[model samples]
Target: MEKNNNEKLESMDTFKKLITALDAKLDSIDSRLKQQQGRKGIVKYYRNEDLKRAFGLSSNTIVKYRLTGVLPFTKLGDIFLYEASKIDKILRDNEC
Candidate 1:
């Protein structure tokens, strides 16, 4: 009876150790995912609708700005993407 109890206790200790190691691995993965998301936030991409809402401008005005080279942008097929960094620079340079 004493030997059986000792064996049970040893198995429980091994199970607890396994749980602790898995918990540490999960925490490390979560931290890496958050770091990657933070890096993406530093260089965000904006679409046409976002620009219209941000600047309170019409579609034609947005096109005019792009066509006149007032703001730099890139178009992939029908979707136009603007860099947040360049937009910030233009706004800062033209600040009143």
Candidate 2:
């Protein structure tokens, strides 16, 4: 009976260690997935005020740019959103 009790205790200790290691590995994988998502899965946006401050653009000029297809923006109700990637490409293409 004492030997059987010792075996049960050893098994429980091993099981607890295995569970702790599995939890650590799962946490590592979750952190890596979050890092990858931050790099590629997320779509960064710029607001109207962001453009105005970054490029010295007037609100009317931004409107004109959008209307004339010089700039592309997404309109959500009263808000405008510009994709950071598209804006970067536009600037790169137009850079002297």
Candidate lDDT scores, in order, read 0.91, 0.95
Which candidate wins on lDDT?
Answer: 2
Error of 1 at 89 (Å): 1.0
User: What's the C-alpha lDDT at position 29 in model 1?
Assistant: 100
Worst 10 residues of 2 by lDDT: 33-42
Per-residue lDDT of model 1, residues 1-96, tens digit only: 999999999999999999999999999999998999878456677798999999898999989999999869998899999998899999999999
RMSD list, candidates in order: 4.2, 5.8
Model 1 misplaced stretches (Cα beyond 4 Å): 1-26, 37-42
